[model samples]
Target: MSNETPLPLVMLRAVVSGGCDVTPPQRPLTPSGRN
Candidate 1:
């Protein structure tokens, strides 16, 4: 598998890890129904 990962995956990880405090409105990148 490639060492490079998708940008969304990285962002998700960051959010899950508490590294990113993204608000629902600010995070339009993900349409996972958070809005």
Candidate 2:
């Protein structure tokens, strides 16, 4: 197999800790999926 790591475990930790360092974003990107 090739050599490439996944993007879940690390991402989860990074985001989890990152959130604690900042207030909630003004607002999430916003729901722009529906038409």
TM-scores for the candidates: 0.42, 0.39
Q: Write down the lDDT that model 2 would get.
A: 0.57
TM-score attained by model 1: 0.42
**Candidate 1: how many backbone clashes?**
0
| Candidate number achieving the greatest lDDT relative to the actual structure | 1
- Pairs that clash in candidate 1: none
For model 1, residues 1-35, the per-residue Cα lDDT tens digits are 35888889888888876744556457688777766
- In the range 1-35, model 2's lDDT, one tens digit per residue, is 13454577668868888875443453445544432
The global C-alpha lDDT for each of the candidates, from Candidate 1 onward, is: 0.71, 0.57
